[model samples]
Target: MDRLTNPIRPYAWGSTTAIPALLGVEPTGEPQAEMWMGAHPGAPSRVDRGAGEVPLSEVIAADPEGELGAAAVAKFGPALPFLFKILAAGAPLSLQVHPDLARAKEGFEDEERRGVPIDAGHRNYKDPNHKPELICALTHFDGLCGFRPPLEAADLLEGLGVDSLKPYVDLLRAHPVDAALREVLTAVLTADRAEMARTVADAAAAAERLGGPYAPYAGLVHHFPGDPGVIAAMLLNHVRLQPGEAMFLGAGVPHAYLDGLGVEIMANSDNVLRCGLTPKHVDVPELLEVVVFEPGEPAILRPEDEGEEVYETPIDEFRLSRYVLAPGAAPHSLPDTAPQILLCTAGRPRAGELTLAPGESVFVPAGETAVLSGAGTVFRATVVV
Candidate 1:
């Protein structure tokens, strides 16, 4: 087992205190967005072995099959397949969607053939991998996921009483699910920027005035008033997750985290296509092709309360589960078939011989015997195979 030293990303939308409070450290007064704990190359966690600290990416590359196990190496290539994170959102994230595997491969190859720089602002596909994610809320996490029914969305918009938005409400009520959602979203994104800003302001005013279900959207408009994403966000279903509940975000699903903290895990990829609520380049044509034009309620997941609580997802790259340890409980014999990252979110949990405090973690290589005991909340991240 290797003691992992992870990297914290300071994104502008990040909370100032949430991560610090978890790490038991003083705040630097800047936003601490995410504490990443896997080998994503962009920000790989470091592990201190006998030879001193080394990047986890390099450590894996040096001996992939030995570290990741033969099954993982054969299935997901010579890599750690998943990236685990502690995400803290203070404001709203970009209205974004991810490409499916086939689309991701096509987009990446095309961009590479065109000689686009990897770090270019307009670059859509970061790598040729699909990012299917699941976020388990540590707090009351607020977010927008998928799409609400067209008629329901129409009713919500119609209630706003904005003249400019009447066209959308009419469109929603006029068409079927796919066309209604697609056309309304297209109209919102392709609208004149100045006109859309005015519409967003009016909508914000109305959302504030009618503060029951509309209260969440009013906050998005508050953060990004001029952003057309505020209007785009209205097309999605608003969801709030209490502690212990989880939400899964699959390919081509339009979503955004509005506020609060969570434990997020996804395939080891960085490909993101934006729809709105950001200064970053949004490829509307690409995003349109990528988004799934379906209307339904978002799945709010609750963990299956087995001996070790498990949050089940449909993908093979990542599997996330948690254990809320009580005083004087028997140690858990964690599965040693795959590589694992054990994160302590509260109290002191023993991982092998090391005692972990909140925000501390360890990387156990495949076949390593790890017995987790002591009182704490520990989240386990491993591969399905």
Candidate 2:
């Protein structure tokens, strides 16, 4: 097991204090958004296995089969299939959706064939891999996920009683579930910028005045006033996750994290299609193609005991499980069939010989004999095999 030194992504939407508090460090005052803990090449974690401190990607690349095990390399290619993260949201992330595998490949290859630069702002697919994710809240987390039933959504908007929003409310009531959501979202995204800005402002004011169920929307406008996503966001279901609760965001699910801290794990891909609420490029046409238009409730996942308490998700790229250690509980053997990143989130737990404090993690190669002992909450990230 190698002690991992991860990179903290200082995105503007990050919380200044949440990640610092977890790591027992002083806030640098800059936003600390995500502490990435895997080999993604973009921000791969660092590890020192005697030779010198090097990026984990280089270490894995040198001996993919040895580090990741033969099965993982064969199954998910030479790269680590999962990217684990500690995501801290001080503000709302973009209203975004990710492409499914087929769409991802088509988009990536299409861009490459057209000679579009990979780093170009307009470029959508960062890689030809589907990014399905699970976020398990470490605090009282707030987010918007999927879509509500059309009439239900219309009721929420109608209650706000903003005149400019009446058209959307009428549209929502006029069409079938999927079409209502599709038309409202299309109108929100494709509307005249100045006109949409006015609507967003009105909606924001109404949300603020209403201030009950409408509070989260008011907060969105507080951060990004006049942004059309403030309106598009209302099309989705609002989810507030208490500690230890989880939500799985599958491909094409339109979602945004509004606030609080969470432990997130996803397939190692960064293909995102944005709807709104960002200064970043909004490929409306692409996003319309990528979003799943069906209305459904967000699935809130809780851990189930299957030797370890697992937060079950459908993707094979990653599996997340939690362990809450008491003072006298017997040590548990870690699953050794896959490469693992063991993160200690609270107290001091021992992973093999390395004792870990909150925010500390270790990279345990596949086939390693590892045991968990001591009193702390540890979240384990590994492949499904």
Candidate 3:
């Protein structure tokens, strides 16, 4: 097992302290967002084997199926087709949707056929796989997932009594799901600039008046001023998950990670169809095509206890288990059947003489059983199918 030095994503929405604290580094004042720990080619985790740092991709390629194991190879082909992340979202992410498997493959191939560069910022699809994701909250995570019933949203907006929002309230009350959403979204996005400014001002005041956690949402309104996403967000289900809780996002789900710390695991793809809430790239037609119009509450995943510190999720690409180990505890004997990555999240943990501090991780190849004797909380990542 080589000591892994993972890549950290520098996003504006990232937390300045959470990941920095984990790595024993003082906050850089800037957001140090996601610390990724997997062999996905986009930003592969690096292995420090005493000599120097090498991408985990190089390590995996040496053995391919052997490193990840036969099961992962059979399920996802000759690759560790998953990416794991310690995500910290201080600000909201773009409201976006991912394509289903078939659509993803087709979209990827089409982009490739057009000679689009993979690293291009405007490129929509990066891989030919669906990005079904599971986020286990490390802190209180607030987000908007799926969609709230239109009538419920209408009631909320009507109660707000912002005349500019009356159009949306009327649309929701009058039209069906697709037409109501499309019409309202179009009007919001393409509204008169001055009118939108006035509308947002009124809406923000109303949002604050409604009170509670959503009062802070008014502040976000100032950032994305007059942006349709602020209005669109009202139509989505507002969800908050406490620590150890999880939420799943399947393809075509119109969702946005609002804020907080979480561990996100997804299929090894970066295909995103963005609608709004950011200035990066918004492919409205494509987004509209892929996003599901269904309205419902977000699906919260409850991990089944397997009686061995194993937390089984409904995903096949990765299985994550949490181990809270105190000092003087016996060494953890991990399963030898598959490749596993052990990440220490709290305190210092020892594997023989090598001590893994918080944020430090170790990648154990398949068919190798290692013992972890530590004074910390460690999360084990391995392929399930």
Candidate 4:
């Protein structure tokens, strides 16, 4: 087991103090968005081996079989299959969707053939893998996930009574789930700039009058006034998760984190097709192609308690589970068949010889069994065999 030092991403929408508070350190005053703990090549964690420190990516590359195991090397081509993160959102993230593996590979190859630079702002695919992520709330978390029923949307629009929104209300009430969502989203994205601005102003005012579900849209409009994403957000489900609850976002599902902090784990990829609420590239046609337009309730994931709380998903690339060690609890044995990253979110916990405080993490190589003791909470990230 090796203690890992990771980099913190300073995005504008990040909180100035959330991550600092977690690590029990003084604030740096800069926005700390995400603390990534993996070998993602973009910001690989550093591992110390007594003499010196080296990039985790370099260590893995030196001996893939020894570091990642033979099975993982054969399946994932000598690279880590998952990326683990501590995500803190003070404001809101971009409204985005990830493409499936087939689409990701096609997009990546096509961009490479066209000679588009990998760091170009307009480049969509950064890697040729699908990203399916799950976020377990470490604090109160709010987000917009998937789509709500069309009738509920129509009710909100009709209550708003905005002249421009009437057409949307009519469409929502007149069509089925898929068609209504497709047409309403298409209208919002392709609306004329001047007309949409006026509609947004009136809608914001109307949303204030009708508070319940419409209230979130009003808040979104305040953050991004005149942005079409405000209107696009009204079409999705607004979800608020308490600590320990989670939300799993699969490929083709549109989502944006609104507020609070969480422990997020995903397949090691960064192929995002954005819709709005960001200064980054927005490809409308590509986003439409990748979105799943079915409307339903947001799927809230609750872990199954079997010694450890297992957060299950239908993916082979990663598995996230949590363990809460009460005072005087027995030491827990970690899985020895796969490479794992163990993160402590609360209190001090000892994993083998490594003692981790809040926001600290360690990388456990395959074939080594690490027993975790002491009181605190720990989240483990590993691949499913």
TM-scores of all predicted structures:
0.99, 0.98, 0.91, 0.97
Please, what's the RMSD in Å of model 1?
0.9
- Cα lDDT computed for each candidate against the true fold: 0.93, 0.92, 0.80, 0.90
lDDT, candidate 2, 41-86, per-residue tens? 9999999878889999999999999899999988999989999999
Judged by whole-model lDDT over C-alpha atoms, candidate 3 comes out at 0.80
Q: State the lDDT at 251 in candidate 3.
A: 86
The prediction achieving the highest lDDT against the true structure is 1
Error of 1 at 26 (Å): 0.5
The TM-score obtained by model 2 is 0.98
Tens-place lDDT per residue, model 1, 1-385, is: 9999999999999999999998999999999999999998999999988899999999999999999999999999999999999999999999999999999999999999999999999999989999999999999999999999999899999899999999999999999899999999999999999999999999999999999988889988777877889988888899999999999999999999999999999999999999999999999999999999998889888876855898889999999999999989999999999999999998998997999999999999998988999999999999988
Q: Is candidate 1 or candidate 4 better by lDDT?
A: 1
Off by over 4 Å in 3: 119-121, 177-179, 190-197, 304-312, 326-331, 351-353
TM-score quality measure for candidate 3: 0.91
What lDDT would candidate 2 get against the real structure? 0.92
Give the backbone clash total of model 2. 0
Per-residue error (Å), model 3, residue 67: 1.3
